[model samples]
Structures are given as structure tokens and as C-alpha cells.
Target: MYRSVGLMAWKAVRALAMSMTVVSGVSGCAAVQPASRTAGAALGLDAYYTQSVGWAPCEEGKTGEWFAETLAGVECGQVRAPLDYRNVQPDGSSGAQTVLLAVARRPAAEEKTGTLLAISGGPGQTGLDLIEAAYPPEVLAHFDIVAYDPRGVGRSTPLIQCAGGLDPDLDLNADDTEALEAAERTEVAACVTDTGLDVLRHTGSDEATNDVDLLRAVLGEERINLLAYSYGTQIAAMCALRFPANYRAAILDGVVDIAERPNDMRLGQERGYQATFTRVASFCVGEYRRDGAECPLGTDPAAAEEIFQQLLRDADARPVPVRGGSPVKATDVLDASYTGLLWPSAWKPYLAALQALRHGDGTAVRRLADFQDSEGTNALTAITCTDTAGPDHRSHSQTARRRS
Candidate 1:
């Protein structure tokens, strides 16, 4: 239910009409030096938290095959965060198990208001590309913009990946424990067999938000403002919770309320998704017009909702065939609709997808679903599974129901 936007690759994603088909996608300073150590001391952390970063021209199109060229004026750096925070030595020897949080930054056009960290949502998101795509020059002028690839995610050294790949055939039925456990087993086995699970065990939110503190220290900022989308909201809130003084400000987008954060997230999502989808359905059917033709769903919004729901059920019953690719199942359609629901700009394409679905075409849905299990989703799987317990684990009790 908490889909990672970084992995989505939703749009053509061109910066100034620069097309980014697959070109994929930090830090500072002195004065900057003593001020950095003081900030770390104030935050009650060690030297790594106060460590000065070596900033350099990003390896975009130069060295790392992963860095993209269109993200202009972005500088890269790597700062260390302890792999194990719980077992730190008295003299602050946590650096031995260190991992990197790759950072990208763009300085303010003139004067600055500390660092504005644009944290992307996902236990496994890469936020650097987002700074240029999501923020305008005006916003960037207010403060130096920064984004980071959290450990085990993109461009972070020794990147963690699953051996068997993500499971797309996951069943969402309330009664389907067998299918769910099987998927989890396959996923966990892959991580254990392919990479050390020990690293993944350390990849949860505690370390990530601590890494945020480490980052704040690197920038020599006493407190950092955050712009977080979706799951990044979780990270932001935790940062505020962990080091309230160090979080100067925060702006959250998508799944904003901290109370509705990801415990029984899937079930929580199902509770509200239908209402939101209905509103979209009503608008599309009532106002959508193309080529002077009647609205695709005609005039009845309820009928449109029913039609879409029926399609999902039918896909569950039997997969819908795509023209040249794999079949679109119920889960695939659900994924497409969920992807479209996150942003309003996607509504037009969503309408197109519905039209395609009506004609027994699975292309639109497949394209939307492709983002869910992209070429590099294993990190997402590993990080996400490591971060939160299963939604089903919380479904059986009164405490869970009350939390919902």
C-alpha cells in the first residue's frame, strides 16, 4: 500500500525537455569545520556525526553507470553512519561498522537558510534526483537543497540486492496467509543466500534517521528542514522525534498523518482507497471529455466504479492478456490504480488506462505495474521488510483495530 515513488519512474521525467529514459541517477565544508563539531556535540553524537564531507563533481556520466546527466548542479559526497548504533563503544568507536549515505547537494542561489533536505519516501529511496525534478529555482534559492541515498539503496556503496528478485504474485486476500508467508519466505531466503542478512538487520529506520543526524552534522547545520514524500514522512517524523532540536522544519506530502503511518498500512490503505477512487471516478465520468467523444465511463460515476472493481475481480479470477507482454492480473490493475491515485497529474493517464482495460488491453496497466517491480526493487523489498512488520501481523487484535 505504501508504494515507493522513487522506484515508480512514473513520468517521462525530462528536465527542460531533456528526456531521461533510463539514465539513472552530495556534500561540504568549513567555517564549516569547527561549527560542524559544535553541532554534533550539541546533538550528543560522535566525530562521524561531526565528520567533514569531501564534496566533488558527481560521477554523472563519468564513472558510476548509475548517475544521470540531467540532474544539473548536483554535488556528491559520502558520509559514514554506524551499522550498529546499539553497540557503540564508550569512546565512540561505532565507525567500525560504518556504511555510507550518499549525498547530493545544490547550493542556494545567494544567501542560505541552512540545508533543506529533500528526503524521498521509501525504506529504499534515492532522493538526489528528486531535488531538481520536484523543486523549482525559487525554492532552491531559499536554502541549499540536499538529497541522499540511504544505506542499502541506490548509489550507496555495497548496495544490498535480493538474489531471487521481488515477488509480484503476492495475494492480497484477507484469508491468504499461505500465499503471503510463501512470498516472504522466498524473499527472505534470497537476501540471506545472496547477501549477509546482518547488513539488512541494521537497515531499519533507527539507523536511517540517525544517518540524518550524521548528515545534519556534516552540513554544519544545527537543525535541518525536511521535505518528505510518502514514506519519507516516516523518516522525517522520526528525525524530529529522535532529535527534536535538530529538525528545524518539515513539509510532508502523501500519507501525511503520523498516526496513519505504516503499521497496518495496507489495511489502513484499503479503508480509504475506495473513497478516494470514487471521487476520481465521479470527476472523470462527469467532466472528462476527449475528441468531442462521450466520457469514457459515460455519465454514471457509480457504474464506472463498479466497472473498475469488476475488472480487478476478473483479473483475480483469470489474468488479462497484454498485447506483447505478461498478463495483467488483479494485483497489476490494483497497482496501476494505486500508482495513479498518488498524484492528480496522473489522472489523465489513469483514464487512458481504464479505457485500455475496457478494451481488454493490459498495456497501460502493465506499464504502471512495471514501476512496482522494476529492475532494482530488491533493495526496496529488503529495506521495507526490514523496516516494518507485516500488516497482517497486526490484523488480528483489538489493539491493532484501535490503532487503525
Candidate 2:
């Protein structure tokens, strides 16, 4: 989405063109088979995974409590890799950053065979956490489920820490000008020094594709079946494009059109939100009418619409008070709205909050702001900024205005 140099720009442009061609000419078609599959026994196939790390099971008469305590239900390990992969060694064990992996085995189904690899999105989100939440279950019954944290994110070694370590309560969109300025100081490159702009410059979609291939090889998978979401789609698409021979089947959701620039994507999102609001009005209009004349705002959708607009304007002018002596500013409003609007399940509560705010009550706004302010791992800032150097303050402001 953000190009670092001429070569990368050309490559991305070419990739985008190909993606468009595929989308127009062959989307939903069967996947192309890999030319070759891994030769040899799969890793951890000697027995099912049942420990944090691979170790022989204890014998009945053994007095070794160390092995007993170390053996768990599955195997987990960290693979240290170079901050820069171009100069990396396959056999080299010293890596500035470590990729964290956790694998679990389920009895293979009688008819189904092959391993399924699940990749999570956010480019910053932890796949380990998602996998722990029952991901890859369908694949697990038939194949082992292998999930790993990407470099510079999650519990991986040399983890990326944003400004003040991504403490979400830091008020990413602080009302105080000084605070906002201070927060922006935690640029992704600055925090992950070992992987500077040079490394970031090389960390494009191509590199991610290679990373998956390397992981596949390490896992001893003949053909990898990938299920990914969000930015994970970016990785999956690249894998399909670059390593077509290694893939078996794949599923992607919340796809990112890698052909689009970061700025254009933001603009596209604004259009999406506008459409969603329109649909919201259509679906909820009847509910408002059924509430009768005593309805808080009015039966007319226009009234609620006016309230929503006015509340956004008001928040821009003044911040709403919240717990911890914090305040909700315009940026907070945008953050809350963007998150809540992403899922339909949150639409109603988000609308109700808007209505309450329009009535001059800050309760709903404060509650939503509080939820939005909760701290998160620094991995998001690291991976996001590294992947697409991000917009300056002015550009960010412009994007926010466009959304409004």
C-alpha cells in the first residue's frame, strides 16, 4: 500500500495489475496446484503434539520429573529470524527477531489428509491468540493446526513496541495537542531499530510470501492449505501469486485490495461507511416508527440523522468527560465510530450512543470511548507502520475530515 522505492513501486503495481486480471478473469475458480510437494515425513508426525516443546514421553518407571512437567498437550516454540530476511541463513539460528509458533494435533479424519495453516489479519494481530480461540478447528480434525506469530509482532522476540508501549489508554487521539504530538513520536521504525527502514523497505508482500513458504517448508507440509482474514488476505494472495505450487486450497475474508494505496484505501473506507449508514437508516426506519410519537428523538429518520451529524460536530469542538480524568475528543469519536461500524452487530449500540449524545448526554459517548481506549500490544503500531509507513499528521487529519 505504501511504496518505499522505485523497484517496490513497480513490483506492487505489477502485482496489482495481475490481481485485477485474476479478479476479473478467474476469481472463484479452482486453485492452481503446486509443482512439487515436500518430500519426507512431516514434523511431529511420529506422535501427536502433547507438550510445549518436543520431548520424548516419560516411561512408567522414570524418576525424571523435568520431562513430566515439560510435557503438555501440544508443542510450542520460537523461531529466531533475521530482522532482514534477504541476508538470512536457513541454518543460522541467531535472529534479531523471533517468530513464535504453537502447534496442536488432532486425530486425522479417516478420509481427510493434509495440514492446514491459519494466518490472522491486522498484519499486527496475534495469530496465536486467535488460534487459541478455536480457529482452524475444521482443519484441525483432519490436519494438524499450525499457527505462528509474525516477526515484530506478538510474543515474538525483539517485539515491536509503539510509543510508550501501545498502552491504549495513552489516548491515541488525545485532545491535548502536546499529548497527540508526543504519541506520534513512537514511529514504527524508531522503535524496532534492528529492523530499520532498510529492512522495512524490503518487507513487502514478496517477503511475506517467502516467509510463508519458509514456514511451510519447516512444517514439512507437502502442500499448505491456508485460511486467512483481513490483511491476512494480502499474505494469502501473495502466496498464491508467488508460490502457487505450494498451495493446496485457501479461504480469505475481509480482503484488502493490495493494488490500492493506503490513502485510497482510507477514501474507499469512507465510501463504505457512507453506504453502511444509508443501509442502517433503511433497516431501522421502521423500528423508529413503531416506537410511536413518544420516541426519544422522533419517528423520522431525518431527526436521528441530524443528531448523529451534530454530535460528531460537537465532539470536534469539545471533548466529553470520561473516567481516569480523560476526555473524548473528535479523534476518539472517529476511532469509536470506525471500530463499531466495522461490524453490523455493533451498529445499533453505536447508533444509540449517537442519539444519546445528540440529546446532550455524554454517557454513551464516554462508555464507548472508554472501551476504545483500552490498551493493546504494541505489535499493531509496529507491523502497520512498518508495512506502510503511514500518513503524516496533516494527511491523517485530512482522512478524518473525509470520513466525517
Query: lDDT at 372 for candidate 2?
Result: 26
Q: Compose the digit string of candidate 1's lDDT tens values, residues 207-229.
A: 77777877887888876666667
After superposition, the stretches of candidate 2 with alpha carbons farther than 4 Å from their true spots are 1-82, 89-98, 101-112, 132-146, 165-206, 283-304, 348-381, 388-404
lDDT agreement with native, every candidate: 0.63, 0.50
Q: Give TM per candidate.
A: 0.78, 0.63
Query: Candidate 2's residue-wise lDDT over 72-93, tens digit each?
Result: 2434554333344444444444
Clashing pairs in 1: 26-75, 26-76, 26-77, 26-103, 26-104, 121-232
**Residue 385 lDDT in model 1?**
62
Q: What are the per-model C-alpha RMSD values against the true structure?
A: 8.4, 10.7
For model 1, what is the alpha-carbon lDDT of residue 357?
A: 74
